[model samples]
Target: MGHVILVTGGARSGKSSHAEARVAALPGERVYIATARPEDDEMRARIAHHIARRGPGWLTLEEPFDLAGALDRTDGRGPRLVDCLTLWLANLMFADRDWSPEADLLIAALARQNSPVVLVSNEVGMGIVPENALARAFRDAQGWLNQRVAAMANEVEFVVAGLPLRLK
Candidate 1:
């Protein structure tokens, strides 16, 4: 029913910038679905920076969790950008929420959307395996989430050194 584009990359690899640019070129007011929760000073600064980076044309919706619920109610007439699914995953993990149900809801919502959606995520499985069990579990969950989203996307791109390599 809608177009979903998946953008994945390593940290600081320009995934968000590319996703933003892709959605900004489309018509209608951009709806930015921010999933980051500012817990500390650095994180707060990061959130502020992200807000400042976006123009006044964007209607920012801060949904650290309940992303599926937000998407279900959001107007699908405009191109929406969900900046970084990785943090959303982390939030779910830390909150002891069932990731599968939330992920399923997100996929369902995406399938019903009437406009384009650019999903940003980190390619975490590419790096060395984690030493801790929790970290390993998070990585595994992230991989699963990315795989699921990629399968639903009309286009999938891997960003490296600020360059996008189309994967689908």
Candidate 2:
């Protein structure tokens, strides 16, 4: 089985950078499974920045909902990095889909992976409770998703200010 690593932190905490480094350090070709959709200009710019930072040595797959399917398709190809699971959860919620089943599928897929998988996620529950119900729901779901992934992961790192603190 492939080694599973989860890197999570607050916004702009360098989780993606750390996850990228972890995947790059692994053997075989590198695959980056991006879940972000360029729905607006700001998001488009962020996606571009990420693409530029990653450079040219990785195969990129844009799968916003079917992450489990993406992992299955790319299994054994190389080390795979799933950047920002929080965005994926948002995508699912916005689409009116239940996130738990998808999360379950993701965990199962990770267990079956033959190449290493490094996942990047945001820690959304650290801040004060949001005033809006939707925001609160998203925060709660994100926390649950992160915990589920961390439990399945062989290694877990919490990044803050560009530094990674191993949690598992």
Which candidate has the highest TM-score of all?
2
Tell me model 1's lDDT, rounded to 2 decimals. Answer: 0.89
C-alpha lDDT (0 to 100) for residue 118 of candidate 2: 95
For candidate 2, report its TM-score. Answer: 0.98
Superposed Cα RMSD, model 1: 1.0
Error of 1 at 79 (Å): 0.6
lDDT of 2 by residue, 15-81 (tens): 8988999998998999999999999999999999999999999999999999999999999889999
After superposing candidate 2 on the true structure, give the runs of residues whose Cα lies further than 4 Å from its correct spot: none
lDDT of each: 0.89, 0.94
Residue pairs clashing in model 2 are: none
The model with the greatest lDDT is 2
Q: Report the Cα lDDT for residue 149, model 2.
A: 95
User: Which residue pairs show backbone clashes in model 1?
Assistant: none
